[model samples]
Target: MSGVGGDDEHIWRLAVQKDGKIVAAGHVATAAGGEDFAVARYLPDGRLDRSFNSSGSLPGTVVTDIEGGRDQLRDITLGTRGRIVAAGSATLPAVRGGTSFTVARYLRDGSLDPSFGSGEPRPGVVVTPMAANDDLDLAESVVIDRHDRILAGGSADADGRFDLALARYRPDGSLDRRFGDAGKVLANVGPGSTDEDLAGLALQPDGRILAGGSTAATEFAVDGDFLLARFRDDGTLDRGFGRGGFVITRTAPGEADDEIFDIALQMPNRLVAAGECDQPATGRDVCLARYLVSP
Candidate 1:
């Protein structure tokens, strides 16, 4: 389940089964340079799985942060052979504005797998870029397909507003060019001033793609609405999604604001979104609901 604390110090991440059962949960409670550090384990029933971590904490490792301290885990994907991979950002000192795509892998026992990239030395172990760019780029969502292909959705800053970014990687951590340009692609949904984001993503049973985020209404302000886009396997928007490939949602009446923090696709083509909505003087409430793909 996707959970965020009101304190703003932590965005709890939990892995749950298809049947509404939570398998693991974790969060980063400190601002250790804003790095993504969290711990989690399987749940036997509704409690923590003692087999992984009795105390419920796992300290991740990093080989290099060419970008310094802005590392964070925005999403996680189960890896082949029973492993977990989290994707987010790594802050590279101010010299570069602390922005870099970052990923980390952990073994089934919740231990940092020394066999992955920059991991422990093994025979013929190779590593490559999952998805990287010069300017500000981040991985906000990730998942492993039935074939074990690593799919990710995120945002990349452009001249001003941000654009949707998608990429796929081989199980070995190498970029898959068959998906997009050098294994990466970008999309601009609306004519916004200085803001855009790819917040959550999910893969359909047939291999189609669904992406969600928001587009700024203005350049100097946060007057924007949430956006959801569906894409074909070729990196093109699926026109049948919302309207010409996308849909936008916002808080009714506009007394406050609404933002979609996460999204999940249910059976057929229905979608579920979870987020927080500011109810003016009432403060913010945890908002959760589902949407249908209108014809």
Candidate 2:
């Protein structure tokens, strides 16, 4: 599907339906402009979904935005009722804003859902910039809880500093006030002179939440480390896990940068964290680490 509209495509994350169907998501070029989130559904036989958004979506039903700026979908998962939920950042073209953490929901039929967002930027999109006036709010991961609540985590910038941010939303697409102050919590995971960027998130069987990513300084600095933390269901840090609810480990002692881009639960209390690390011999090596659940 390459065309003059800059058909460059990069798929970041995807989900498989219970029926064996697959849905791939990422950002697609915009002719001579920026990129908008591109989502494609495929049949089990590896055929494109010809019945999805046939004529209403655009560019072969690959677009999901309303009618403004460019957006990106970094992580995605299947929600209840077979809804497709994606998360990333958006450059609000309507307000000419820089970028804000965004979450969008789509029906199983590949059309935008009308229950998300507050009707500002659109109807099916959820735009949460942390402050709406902040510099940037970007989401790196998204997941659905046992109760079907939507949870997204990343970094939120304020005072020129970045902090770990996690927000919980009800199935109806409304903020769950019972959560961290209206369904949002921001934690300063970097104690030193650095910022923490949450890249991965996992839900424990006990309803607790686990997050993994990187913590380091910006501005051409190369001394970053991997960060992992555990949180209770109420959004509070799990003090029993690590030193003050978080742990920072480095894959490379004093080399470039290291981070846990993704994490998964092995059983009850065990977790597997995987990402790229700077290796002294091979330059970049695939790093994997295992952690006890109680730790």
Candidate 3:
């Protein structure tokens, strides 16, 4: 489901069958709230999941319409026992910066899982920003690990720069400190660059990690470049993956102008990266390339 309308509109997180068929989808539009938006669900085969919110809709009470805040769902992943986990952000007066990262879990039947995170299906996991300036911190991606742990990735600016921040949570919605400091890790990437940020992340079946984003020299817009880093399950840099667990993809001949928005893994340690490349000659095109992990 997707919200269609204005700046506060959002789409519903969907579930698909193993055969690549969309079983259910629904969205809560801003029009339903006058100025705020809500979440909805759909059933298998592109129909509304009526089981959700009595005809497929659920409004958030934490961020009320009177709070001058907006709520939106970002990504969703299915969990064990028919549980669903979703990541998003909501602005609230109670929070230090008026916004906080939200994660919620739902039962297979589309009901909020009271067993998770204070009975809030959304943000079954929660990680508030460290400072007031971090009102925009949000979780962009989420995945489950072998141990039933949940991993989340996004950007934050508590220290200074907009660096990549990662968090891990137990299935019960508690933080996982074994992965990073208080279940969170941050990487600046480009110390002197204008804007350093992480875009996407993936976990290798073998317990390795890959994160992709952009980097620049001196400033974010002066000359951008693609950046990828690989880490071990213990959160240590994977020296064998790239140059010290890092790969910088830039325009051929070193003009230094490109950005990576997504990445995927192929068999036998082969990887495919997709994004945009501001090549000197090609100007810019949908960038796609393959790379083999170095021996």
Candidate 4:
């Protein structure tokens, strides 16, 4: 669909409401050459749901400028009471590795939820810097737990290297101190890996968490492997699962690159991951892998 001024738009995630309305979150280019977080709602018939953001300039869409900089929502999850939680990264031009993990909650009508992040730097928005030095931090996947807590997963820079990172937030947009250290957890799937990024997140029936992404083998490696990590409710690694709570898989033969961009849990005891793998003859090929969840 057309975005703000029909500028370049990139949708990163979509969710269907209980009533069959489709909600999409992404980023739209701005006149200043920056990007803004954009959300739109559509009816089941593929028509814009003008019922959303009715009073706003755009009938069915809401565009937010988190910091007057580059703000994009890479993932969105529908929470209880029709609340929408979106997560991604916010970047400022002046700071080194300026990106920070950003999350915003919106009401069903596409307006910012004033109850969240009300007293923070910005109302209805939460920006988390994973590193003290302003290193790059991004939240690519988001999920709401049974308790209504929000969980965002992506990558955090760790001394120049990237590690799979997860952050949990309370309903009020405050970091849940009960989760991981200070509400944040970082996992390095492969030792010596230069980059480890989480692109998908899932919650198990038992309250555990699953994260899937990719890990590059070396500093300048062109090849990567699918990486998976499981964690307990409190955010510690689930040692009983894959080797030390992490799994690395090479989807293709030889020194090909493989990365998992999304993951889903099967009913009983299986997990499926989908992404892309470098194929020797066909360049890049879609790849899917199923794993048996350890009892």
Candidate 5:
């Protein structure tokens, strides 16, 4: 609500700078068309950093693909040398029907990094993985790997059902095909009959990847359990953890729908995740789960 916009706006994610400054990222609604990635920086005392983007905030877009459709920033992270990396989804304006996972990087001065994702062909160099088949793709969280690579986590529509999607890119914004299948991995947590999403991601000290979200068992049903998965550095599922590298916790099982909105490491090989749970009898409640990180 701090933002001045008559239309609906949102601050999806934020990150802290090493200098104690704050960088906030989200989307801003435009009068001419769709939303654009809106980013701003603030000093420790809460004063807007006038030096950022040469203003309180970048007046125009910092990153986008679709000129007439929506773009939303789901998460941001502090990268090497204090650079800023952002992840979200951009609607495909040229394609009449879908969205794509979008990412962008900015220098310390808040200027777009030229070496980052600049698209020319289908996922040629952009943070997005090229879509061989049409599907709505979205990036909900992002983290920097030990090698300074970029890893994105979210959901993708596969045959109309949402599946956990993760993409890894080099520091220069090029997809790392050596990772997942062609630089991306779509994990089916449900039976391909329900929805699933990766809401958060954490890169382990050993280069393993941990992702957490939610998934439902019933087809098309919203009620589900908190889902967690681990991946090796090479993007293959880790069979040692959970059941075939997956964990599902049902707080209310068939009685309510649960979800994980964020996750963090608790140190010493422990992880904690938190979100909201809804039920017919008891409105909404804060949900939390912690696990020993063996991956």
Candidate 6:
């Protein structure tokens, strides 16, 4: 509804609680010219929920500075016991314009859960550096599993190229080594030089993970294709799915960009993806695609 900080605020994701309360999260511009993760809870009627963050300067709002730099929440999900988990990217000021996958967990009262992340970076915040060379990595989507484990999907720099990246964290916020290579997995949907990013993530009924986004042929390609990748519970590619666990679809015939910003699982054997596809004649148009879950 209204601005939370009076300054510039951008809401990129929203989640509704089982009790009908709505949670909005994004980034708020700080007076210092930096940004901080901002979250606010509102009742179904659009009124601020005073019950949240009541002790803060702004009722029903919580602002977190993960690394004292730029922080934003691109996706929000409800966790076990009504906890809120948000995922996005945080700038690492020490890395010279580098960013990393950032996640923060909050209790029902909008208080940071100190029991979550290791205090190396910040309390109640988990900062994951996808590359050792300090590259830009971001988590655009987040989902919590039945076991309360957290899964974040986005893009990670792979040797100066962007690839679809996924990371799983245990309930305690520690990297789940049982997942990919130390709780992280990166998939190259196109050529090694292509940039692939995952903006949507969904868990199938059987716990399989599905991520969808876009892949650009070049670093500055004006046109791109929709990209989807499936992974087993253990984080390995689902070979039984699309070609080698990846599917690339060009929504339009020629030079047009088709990006999937979100995905949903539709029962027995289908998944639906929605985003925008650029049309040469007419600006960008809404696009939707359905895929069979099987090979």
lDDT of 3 by residue, 74-168 (tens): 66677787566766555666635555566666666555666666644343445355334544665666677778887776666644456666777
Rank list by lDDT: 4, 6, 2, 5, 1, 3
Give a tens-digit lDDT track for model 1, residues 1-295.
Answer: 1222112334446665443434332333333443343445545465544555332332222222223354556677666666767677655544443365555666665556664544313311222222234467777887777778777778777765577888776666667778778777888776444466777888787777878776655531255566778888777788887778878777534635566778888875688877766666676677776778533
Of 1 and 3, the candidate ahead on TM-score is 3
Stretches of candidate 6 off by over 4 Å are 95-97, 118-121
Ranking 5 against 6 by lDDT, winner:
6
lDDT by candidate, in order shown = 0.60, 0.78, 0.60, 0.87, 0.77, 0.86
**What is the full ranking by TM-score, best candidate first?**
4, 6, 2, 5, 3, 1
For model 4, the stretches where C-alpha displacement exceeds 4 angstroms are 93-97, 219-221
Worst 10 residues of 4 by lDDT: 215-224
Q: Which candidate is the best by lDDT?
A: 4
Better lDDT candidate (2, 3):
2
lDDT for each residue of candidate 6 in 88-165, tens digit (9 for 90 to 100): 999886664379998899999999898998554567898888765788898899999878899999988888778888
Report the C-alpha displacement of residue 139, candidate 1, in angstroms.
2.2
lDDT tens digits, residue span 124-205, model 2? 7877756346477788899999898999999887667678888888876777888887888888765564677789999988
Instruction: Residues 171-282, candidate 4: write the lDDT tens digits.
Output: 9999999999989998886656567878899999888999998888663136788888999999999998889998889877876788898999986578999999998889
What's the lDDT for residue 96 in model 6? 48
Quote each prediction's TM-score.
0.73, 0.90, 0.77, 0.95, 0.90, 0.95
**2 or 6, greater by TM-score:** 6
Please list the residue runs of candidate 5 whose C-alpha ends up more than 4 Å from where it truly belongs after superposition: 1-6, 55-66, 94-97, 118-132, 219-221
Better structure of 1 and 4 per lDDT: 4
